[model samples]
Target chain A: MNLYYRGYLLGDVRRFPHWSEPSDAAGAEDAALADETIVYLRDDFSVVRSPVGADQGVLWDAMTPQWREFCDTVLRFRPPRESADGPA
Target chain B: MDRPDLGEQERGQAVGLPYIVQGGGENLADRLAEDRAAIRDRLRTDGAVLLRGFDVGGTDGFAEAVRALSGELLPYEERSSPRETIKGRVYSSTEYPPHEEIFFHNENSYQQSWPMTLYFHCVQPPAAHGATPLVDTRRVLAAIDPAVVQEFSRRRWMVVRNFHPDFGLPWQQVFGVADRAEVLKLCGDRDIDAEWRSPDQLRTTSIRDAVHVHPDTGEPVWFNHIAVFHMSTLSADLRDGLRELFPEPDLPANSYYGDGGVIPDDVLAHVRDCYRSAATRFDYRRDDVLVIDNMLTAHGREPFSPPRRVAVAMAEPTDAGARP
Candidate 1:
């Protein structure tokens, strides 16, 4: 189960055995960034990266404490819009 | 067996897979307060996210969840698929037969203005194979051959639509206007080229970019309904039957180059291949919610078995105009 505090997903709290991390993939850097790792979060509370130069970062476990804290502090949850249709 | 508090951690299997957050019987109000910013950032970066096991059980719960995300609600105007408005900002999902597979396309991408965000609430998941498959548009752009992408970008694309009361959706239903003057005014506002074949029949064409860049991230994404709208999507038998009824130009819907040239079959085939290879899918559970940035991702439906009902809500309308 993913635990989120104030819309920020808290990491290092769980493990996902079924997911296979992609290998040595590199997307063209976002036009706004230069020489920075393109980091994204995976479903299992793990952080992932596209390879940088020759460095293929470790999978699911390389998320640093600082990154985790940043996500925890900055992420916000958005709920569904209110509707009269009521719950299903 | 594991305790429920441990959380079900099901990871996706691709580079652009959606991140899933499972609920632990907590009220959605509490969940929204915990991470609205994280959810937004992930959506901007990841394209799609799923929330399962939450209290979003019915139309009210679904609407409440959507409201918590953003109060901005977009109108479902200029629709292509058949859907009925259920309540305030909530509508039934596409009403296609269960046996048919809906091809991948961005919601309302054919229109000049479309909802920036989309939410899907699953009331009852099918007993078998009712998965709403998603593909990250960024990944799709990356996967397609650069040469083909460049050619499409240069040529742009034009969608041709003919609304006939005898077949498909009539102009009245499509534009939601009964009077011709109102329909003409609406079309004029959006730069749609409209012509009247008869008092009730109408044909329209709109040219749009085959690719679009996200406003927030500046990431280029594949954003068009070219493959789905093209004649190639129809089986030969269906195509022949349709041709017997109307000329190629008078088909319910079709696509071509903005300059009125033919788009080759091989090009569309290449695009379909990319979508198939890049798609990531997961089964929908009752009360699950899937949120997506409309321009950042594309969505489609797979053939399902029984008892599937999904409701949709859209918000944050953005006008792409003639460009991204």
Candidate 2:
């Protein structure tokens, strides 16, 4: 899923299994990102980005905390729309 | 999912793929009336918006929500795939078999007039893999080889369709009329050329410019049914059977150059590839209402297991007035 603020791509939280502590986003098991400033949300619920021009950064995990937070916060503010025509 | 219990909420707009907005409950209709302007702005910027987890009252509320955002709803004219009407202006999504993928195209892009906006409400999501795939037409235009785009722009595009008593949708069902003279009049008014090869067989042809300028945004969009209706886009088995049974012009459906010449197979493939490359797809959840700016985005269905129900409605009739 992509996260957008004012129609522009903000960093998004996505899930893919990783083999080890992420050296870089490219070296992570997920499909590589090209030269993006890779940010990692470690299991401790803290956010960290790889050093500038650094080759590697270790990440314990990016977990349910960020995902749940984004969803709850956005929905609380945004207040989604609705449709009828429920199941027959 | 654990979210902190806050005393109150901050209000603003943010977008996701399809730009999800949530939290309308029993007062969905009123909330819709209040937020309609915001929703319209989001749709224009995002191309699509998915409204999730709301009561929406019922079918009446659905129509109310649509009316709040887009003034009037439209009937599905110039029909292609089979669909059943659900309520006054609501319809079941195209009634193709579960296993067939409906390729990406803007709704009614082949017609002289089309809906500027589309609304889809998921009643029941499929057992598996029944996503509505989307492609931004602007991205499709950017990805195509300029040479192919130039050719299509210069020549425009043509769609030829054959209707027979025993095969596909007959003239009556396709035209929503039984009178021959009425059909001819409809064709003439719509700029479609109609010919009768036999008492029961009819062929109609339409030439349309392949590119369109977005009415509000003023951006050129690669919009049409060119790749979608081209013969080469069909599955090989179906293609072989149809080709063996009928000549090109007599096939159930096909697309060509504006002057009635064949579009190259490779060119069609490239067009399809461009659409696929820019495509984004998502699974449906019940009560998820997806609103789309039709001209800016192309949508299609994925083959599914079974029991998928999505209700659709079109609004804001827009005529692409300049015919080729």
Worst 10-residue stretch by lDDT in candidate 2 chain B?
B1-10
Q: CA lDDT, every prediction?
A: 0.69, 0.69
Instruction: Evaluate residue B298 in candidate 2 and report its C-alpha lDDT on the 0 to 100 scale.
Output: 88
Candidate 1, B47-92: lDDT as tens digits:
7778777787578877777777766567788888788788887998
Residues A41-71, candidate 2: write the lDDT tens digits: 3223333342111332444344455444653
Give model 2's docking category.
incorrect
Task: Give the candidate number with the greatest TM-score.
Answer: 2
Model 1 CAPRI rating:
incorrect
Supply DockQ values for each candidate.
0.03, 0.06
